[model samples]
Target: MNCQTLLIDDAPAVRLQGAAGDTVTVLLRGAQVISWVDASGVERLYCSPASPLKGPQAVRGGVPVIFPQFAARGSLMRHGWARMRGWTLQPWDTSAPEPSVSLQLHNAVGDDPQWPHACVCTLTVSLLPNGLRMALTVENTGPASFSFHAALHTYLAVGDVAQTTLAGVLPEGAVLSLREPIDQIFEAVTGPLQLHSPLGLLRLEHAGFGDVVVWNPGPDAGLADLPPLGHTAFACVEAAAVMQPVALAPGAHWQGSQTLLSGL
Candidate 1:
């Protein structure tokens, strides 16, 4: 494992790299992955330069950690508090099988008025020859059972959103009609999925999470926080638990991952 430190808005970040030239960059703020580049030096994840580099505000792109809640459908605010707060870097064994770094978030570290649950979240980023992988493990530390949704909210770059196709249950390379904005969640999917993009072919594979979320905020999304014209550069194809929240008893834990690999 290889680790390097850099700064974004004076906030410390870590970069992990593999022998094949695969790289993953993570910011300590929210433990958010700001970049992922495969061998050959092609950026695989999309993080708009317009996005907020410093938080308490969520960065508008890349693989942001969404934990304890997936969206506004909960008592907490939209997408929960994990993405908006800072995280601590943990001591990682560089001798691990892959280039990896881990970040952790625990309730004692901060205060969120609406969410009072005691929990711990661990996010690990790694580099492999053909893919960039992320694993999120959440543990319930409270005395009672609690349920929540989580996702690796990934914003993938595309040359033209209208030219992208998410290969799915449809046949003969049936296209995912991009004529309109897409904001939908797919549940109970079994395995890997391939997304054909203007950038390249992106393959997403996950386990422990059963729902797949795809979203594209067209010109009419009207989100005041979104960067101007930011919607045009990427598509969100995520690994999530949105259809149903995962329930964890006291001391119990759950884990999920999303691996992205691209080929031109």
Candidate 2:
């Protein structure tokens, strides 16, 4: 395994390469996994070419880290401050078998005053032989207890979103295919899902999360960051905990993870 720091559009980023030839690149801006290529040279994560590489806004694609809030559920911004804040990279043992890296986020004085709660959030990305795994851990460091929602908003690259089918999380034998606008939240989802695309079969599994959000704005959503018809090349399948906000006492911690395996 190998790890290195490099620039992506002049922004700092870390790239980890596995012994098996798979690689994952994470940006320090959002601790976001912006790229994941399998050993066979298949790019599994979708990143918008029009999205700003460095800014207060979150990138349009990749696996974005959403914390302290989800979407417009609270007054703290669309997806909270985690994805917009810069993260500090944590040291890791290079001797470890898996090629993994971790970035840490903590609230500071005079940060977003809307939801002022001291906290520490960590995002770890590990590359597998055929895919990758992402884990998020949040710890309350303030004097008061706080409640929040979090998710790993993962956008998967596909040959054609209209030809993709997702199974296992929905009703038995009821696969989901996207052709139009889709925004559905499934509660208490504890099973793994299978995404069949024109490229191959991608397996998705989640841990420590109860909700799975499937979303797509369709071809005409007119998202500024996405190119024309960009929605048809990817799909969003997020592992989340949003139905009920997690209440953490001072010094308490919570963890959740999402794993994607290709050709499984």
lDDT winner: 2
Candidate 2 per-residue lDDT over residues 139-179, each given as its tens digit: 98889898999999999998799898888767767888776
**lDDT per residue as tens, model 1, 110-175:** 376677678999998888778888999999888878788999999888767777778752445455
* Lowest-sum lDDT 10-residue window in model 1: 169-178
Q: Give lDDT per model, in order.
A: 0.82, 0.89
- The prediction achieving the highest TM-score against the true structure is 2
Clashing pairs in 1: none
CA lDDT for candidate 1 = 0.82
Clashing pairs in 2: none
Which TM-score value belongs to model 2? 0.97
Q: What is the lDDT of candidate 2?
A: 0.89
